[model samples]
Target chain A: MRPFLYERADQPEAAVIAARIQGQQQAPPTAAAAQFIAGGTTILDLMKLDVMQPQTLVNVGKLPGTIEMSDQGLRLGASVKMAEAAENEIVKRDFPVIAQALQLAASQQIRNMASLGGNVLQRTRCPYFRDVSYSACNKRNPGSGCSALDGHNRNLAILGTSDKCIASYPGDFAQALIALDAQVETLGPNGGRSLAFADLHKEPGDTPNIETQLQPGELISAFVVPTGAWTRRSLYLKIRDRESYEFALASAAIALDMDGQTVRGSRIALGGVATRPWRAREAEETINGQTLNDETARGAAEAAFRGAKVYSHNAFKVELGRRTLARALLDAGRMEI
Target chain B: MGFSMSQSEKPGGLNRRSFLTATAMGATLPVIQQARAQQAESAPADPRAPVDVKLRINGRDQSLRLDARTTLLDTLREHVGLTGSKKGCDQGQCGACTVLVDGTRVLSCLTLAVMAQGSEITTIEGLASSDGALHPMQQAFIDHDAFQCGYCTPGQIMSAVACVNEGHAGTNDDIREYMSGNLCRCAAYPNIVAAINQAKNEMRKA
Candidate 1:
């Protein structure tokens, strides 16, 4: 890893100022100038792989780390460690999907150090993108052809695939946030702004280089999840090669608002099968006002994977993802809460 | 001459004009300026220079001058001589470098030493009492024969201690789920879980 200047920010404004100072030196500003360091799990891993090179790092771990719960719902600070949020009593009670997503995402040690904000912004685990020796990853180097398109792409995305990139967004918590309609609060040079969690990640379009809508020097301060009828009846179902400490092959975060047996409303998000955190609104609409049973669950699952594109080795993901959603929906529907 | 004396005697000492006058008389002002320029050009870029970091490890404060990229794992093994925490996979995939920061288990391989500035770090070396008595978790590992190759013992023990403290070791499955981070290639998982359970029971009894 290359040596870089390190600055600790005592406040959110100071961190943004330091980032703005470094942002001026680089044109078409990206995260490479002065990246905010929180948890240091993803950034350090990329730095060691030579995939990311930042000239300066602004440490934002010292910023306020709070986990507030109220009638408005849970407000998780950006710096709150993943494990803390996963294990919080309020989070587990009100937002089981959020807690389960965090718990099942990474190893125990990683969850202990990784912050909520950092977890959502973690880069894809595409081998081509991670190993810099490959010169064809467009996400790593813009305009380069994606090697995964023709190479080992069994784990590549099936949805939101452009000709430019096929790397899957390897995160679980973001799916839960999208399913629950969480809002991301960010502080930047222009001041504070709130955006839907669904807008956090962008599809790998021709400009796969620009991943997020966040401007340079913007620091995510907190994630506010509003109270909802479906919050308590939500579950995150992950299927992977191993039982734990592995990225999902295909996962589903499902929440159902049931009036007796009929579904009043539903929220569904799929992970490990798409280029971005994927919300299946069409699937949700299919199951709305209908009773959740084997037939209905299967129909909704099929609707979820309606536009899925397949490769040689990843055709299994479409079926696996459908089953995952079906099982999660049925499981969540059966909950007595 | 009066002006020179007064300039030299100024409280601030060595005014730029006086220094230039002294160097001019010595007839090496141009050479000195050229040397200064060379030094400036040869100096490392500011961002690449090593930074001083202070870490509280094993109940002692140790200060180190390290590159900004130095990880806590490297700082402990290479600089502080605490080699008990192994670096199996430098990436966060494996938990061989697990240590306690403020009593919470974290991966030292991914943790920059500078980020641990104000936190209390407890490594495998600090597990035993100063009188040479083993910690309950350490003794449990021995009693249960939890390890064979022993490369992942330190991390497993640290995580087990934390798991028990966090009340995640209530059952066999809970131990397996929570302790999934530490992987033992020797496949000593059953014994490891037994050790953690024993340790948790002993601590509860105490």
Candidate 2:
């Protein structure tokens, strides 16, 4: 790891100011300056791999760590540990998909230490992305071309991909957040603001280097998920090579508000098969106002992967992704309340 | 246990205003006297300066002046001479460097020594009782033959203890899921699960 300045920030505003100051020191805005470190799971791992090199790190763990629930919905502070959020009684009862996604991610030890904000912003697990030796990664180096395009693309993205990058978003919780129409609250040098969870991550269209919409000094303050009739029925289904401690090969988050076997409303999202957290709006539209039988579930699943573009090595992901969605939908439909 | 920064008041009673003033001066001054004085004299010439870190390891307060790049794993094995925690991948991928920070299991290899300041850290060496009796988890691992090469034993034991404490050792599947972070290339997973279960029962009794 490279030598860097470490500054602990006890207050949220102070952390943002420190980051803004560090960012100004760098000549170019693109230069990696100050990064916020909460759990140190992603940042430290990338630093060790030499993939990410931030000159300064502002410790933002002291900002807040609350998981508040109210009539409106649940508000999860960014600093809350993944394990704490996953095991919270309100989270499990109100948003089973969120709990399941967090529980299914990484391992118990990692979940204990990783913060919710860091988890959502975690980088792709593409071997080429992690290994700096691959200089052709456009995400790592813009206009350098993507090695994973023809390289071992078995685990790469099949949807929301471009010629520039195909690294799949290897996270589970973000999928649930997007499905439930969650909102992200952020505090930065410019002050506080809220944005839809869908706007957090960017597609690898031209600038795969620019991953998130967050500015240099922006710190995710909290995530607010509005309560819905479908929230209780939501669930996340993950399919991986191993039953535990592994990234998903394909996963699905599904929530449905049903009226006597007919879908009154539906929200669907797919993971491990897309460039970003992908909300399957088309799939939801296909199933809404329709009965959630095997046929309808299969139709929705097919619709979810309709735009998937598979390479030679990842053609199986398209079918596997569809099956994951179908299975998740069926399982969520069978949930009692 | 008194290594917490929250417990230690600044000697000069510097408040937020004075701290901010010091930071501004440090940034502007080519050679800040106070900043230079705080750096470790033994630190090698490098762009990164050494930072003073205090940690409560095994219920004992310890202090070390280390470079900003030094990881908790390296600080323990190299500086503090507590080599019980093994570094498998030197990344967060492997749990060989697992340690309990403030009663929560975390990867010490990914954790910087400075970040662990003012936290209660429990390593493999701290697992046994003061009387030298083996920890229940350690005893169960021995009984179940949970390891072959023994390189990953310390981490496995630490994680197993945490898994039980976290109440994830109720059944075989739960144990396996919770203990998945600690991997043993010797393929001793079955034995590891058995050891964790046995230890859970023993600890419950105690």
Candidate 3:
């Protein structure tokens, strides 16, 4: 609850420019720094936990002309609420899986306030990391000992985890986007550029804080999903400890194109059990040229968790992940093309 | 910002309809003591700093700037003089603190007042008509008898409004799933479902 200055930008460029100016204005070793505010759900939550300390918050929610929808696909403003994006006619009709994922990801209230961009960028909800006094989260403080590596880590990562960090990417929407091969548009100091959605998240290797590939002073403007036959045949399956308002213990997003009864091409991504929105390339390859059946689906599912490594408390995730992926693929296969 | 509810607005002056309506809504709120009593005999010590907050409840932007640590639950009752929203767990586990931000329902205890600004917020107080007409949902709650102790009523009503708006009240199971976030200690879930069903039917009529 530290005091901080606030400014609402009228334009996206102005917000970016203001952020850059604020970053430059801060003298070395000074406390006066600015952070971009979008949705304010995750950032504020972290701030309350003393995980982030910024002197200024540049309000980017009111930035003009960021949301748009066209023949290209839905272009959601970075600040567009997750609930709105999930329920958008174009998204729900063209990509019901994405809609279902968002619907089941968070509670209705959180979905209402959380933005599409915010959902993609939400940090891990690791309890130890949020509680800074615990002194065991590499993501919160790099090079520090990871308490979760040995402690209660039932919700921690099972894939792409390192001895340094085992936190998972706790985003439901990102898995769907990765499955659809969405593109992310960002406006940085050097102007605008587009990146493959799947490439946005970096591996947890050493620096878990540097989670995404976006450069400093960069603002995500919109995310676009390209039109394809697979777009209409997508499904998101999340398995959590509870029925609602819970993060996935193991989730999968699947999009497939079928030729009669045979699988043509498919995109698969795993969530809650991986460090990133994991695209299951092995599973996709295994399912290709094969008909939709329990055996083939189970083989692809097995391929999805081929090299999954287990931690002290997360050994259950490997089996849960395999089953979740198998169920998602079979569900997608049942959809009418 | 200059608006405030009249200090003379007495909780006792509430009409029979209003009283029954509030009770109907309050009936949905959780009486935590009862819940704990039923759960078991085991007990454990709890340790957490209490944060104080002064929210601008309803139209009156009252400021009781508290311990930067008070929750919205303690803030409304202790500072802003509004007690419609109940505190079930003080944790985000229950949806008893559900209130509307602009038009969307949120767990107020989890939200800080400083974050809510320039948005036309509404609570159970603002959900009714100025002349004391009960909101359709309130009437529906009474008709459906959606509560037992009435502690969780306000939150249930608030979330019910949101559910209809979000189109999540389509079926009985849908209402049950969406309303799962709010827990009624009285185990009056059947009545709550009936209330939501009645409210959806009323909304459809409108």
Candidate 4:
């Protein structure tokens, strides 16, 4: 890790102001000179790999770290640890999908240390992007060639590829958040604003380096997952090489509001198969007002991976992703909620 | 300062990386070797300056100045002279660097020492009583033979203690899921689970 100055901000406004006093910032917030350190999991990990070299770290862990659940929705403070939210009784009872996603994402140790704000903004697990020795990661270098295109891309994204990059968005909580239509609230020097969770991550188009829609000094303050008809019936299904502690190969976040045997409204987000926390709206549309059967579930799965582009080694992901979603839909259809 | 190390920094037109790349196994070793040499040449080059941090460890308080880049694991093993917490993989993938901050288990390798100023950190060295009686988790590990080489023992023990306290050791499957972060290369997982099972009951009584 490079030598850097660390300052703790007692408040949100102070932290934003401290970050705006940059040293060597880039156009993207990921490469900014000053970064806000909440849990310091992703930032520190990348720094040790020499992938991120921020000159100043403004600790904003003191930002409103609370979890409030009411009839309105689940209001999760950005600085709340993953374990806290995962173990919350209300989240477990009302939003099993959210709790399960958080629980199954990382180890118990990581969950205790990592903050919700930092977890959503976690980077890709692409070896090419992580290992600095590889010179051809478009995500790490703006115009450089993509190494994963020709390298080991079994874990790369297929849903949101733009010929510029294929790195998968390695996260679980974001999938649940997007499926639930969560709203992200952020604090910046200019004040604060709220945006849809889907708008938070940018697809790796020509600019893989610019990962998030967040401004240079903006800090995510909370994630508000509103109560909906589909909230109670939601669940996340992740398929990985192992049973635990591994990134997903293909995962499905499903929230289905059923009218007896027919689907009323549904939200589907695909993880470990896309460049961002992907909302499979086409897949959701295929099942809405339609009977929840094996045929309908299979059709939704087909619609989910309609845009997937497979590489030399990752061709298994498409079929695997399809099967994963089909199984999740069928299983969720049988849920006793 | 944008990721200063790259393939182009190979010193000349014909470098070892290029040679290895032509042979199909090109990278990763040379950079690690180069970094090791850099460390040997100027150990602890505190160019960025140090920050004052007072840490409460076990039951004692220690005031010290550390480079802001120094991790809690490094602070424990180097400055505080507590080598029980090992550094197997400094990047938080391995659990050899696990410790308890504010009675909750965390990867010390990923946590900056300065960030731990206000928290009470407990390492393997702090597990034993002043009268030399080992912690229940430590005793259970010995009884169950939960280690072979024991490189990951300290972190495993620390994590196991937290697992019980966190109510995550309810079942064998739950124990396996919760302890997934800590890797034992010796395949002593079954034994570790047994140890945790034994300790969890003892822990509940206390």
Which pairs of residues clash in candidate 2, taking residues 3 or more apart in a chain or in different chains? none
Off by over 4 Å in 1: A25-31, B1-45
Q: Per-residue lDDT for A56-152 in model 2, tens only? A: 7778775567999866589999999999999999999989999999999998878987899999999999989889998999888878999998999
The alpha-carbon interface RMSD of model 3 comes to 20.1
On a 0 to 100 scale, what is the lDDT of residue A38 in model 4? 84
Ranking 3 against 4 by TM-score, winner: 4
Task: Look at candidate 4 and tell me the lDDT of residue B29.
Answer: 36
Q: Using alpha carbons, what is the TM-score of model 4?
A: 0.91
Give model 1's TM-score versus the native structure: 0.91
* Candidate 4 residue pairs in clash (backbone atoms < 3 Å): none
CA deviation > 4 Å runs, candidate 4: A23-26, A70-72, B1-47
Docking class of 1: acceptable
Better model by DockQ: candidate 2 vs candidate 3: 2
Better of 3 and 4 by DockQ: 4
Q: In model 3, which runs have C-alpha deviations exceeding 4 angstroms?
A: A24-32, A64-72, B1-79, B87-93, B109-115, B142-145, B148-151, B203-206
Q: Model 2's CAPRI class?
A: acceptable
lDDT of 4 by residue, B56-160 (tens): 988889888888889999999999999999999998888999999999999999998878877899999998989999999999999999999999999999999
Q: In candidate 3, residue A242 scores what lDDT? A: 80
For all predicted structures, in order, the TM-scores are: 0.91, 0.92, 0.82, 0.91
Q: Candidates' DockQ values? A: 0.23, 0.29, 0.08, 0.21
Candidate 3 local lDDT, A68-147, one digit each (tens): 56786767677788778777887788888788888887777677667787689888877788788988787777778888
Q: Compute the lDDT of residue A61 as modeled in candidate 1.
A: 82
Q: Give a tens-digit lDDT track for model 1, residues A207-246.
A: 7777888887789999999888999999999999999999
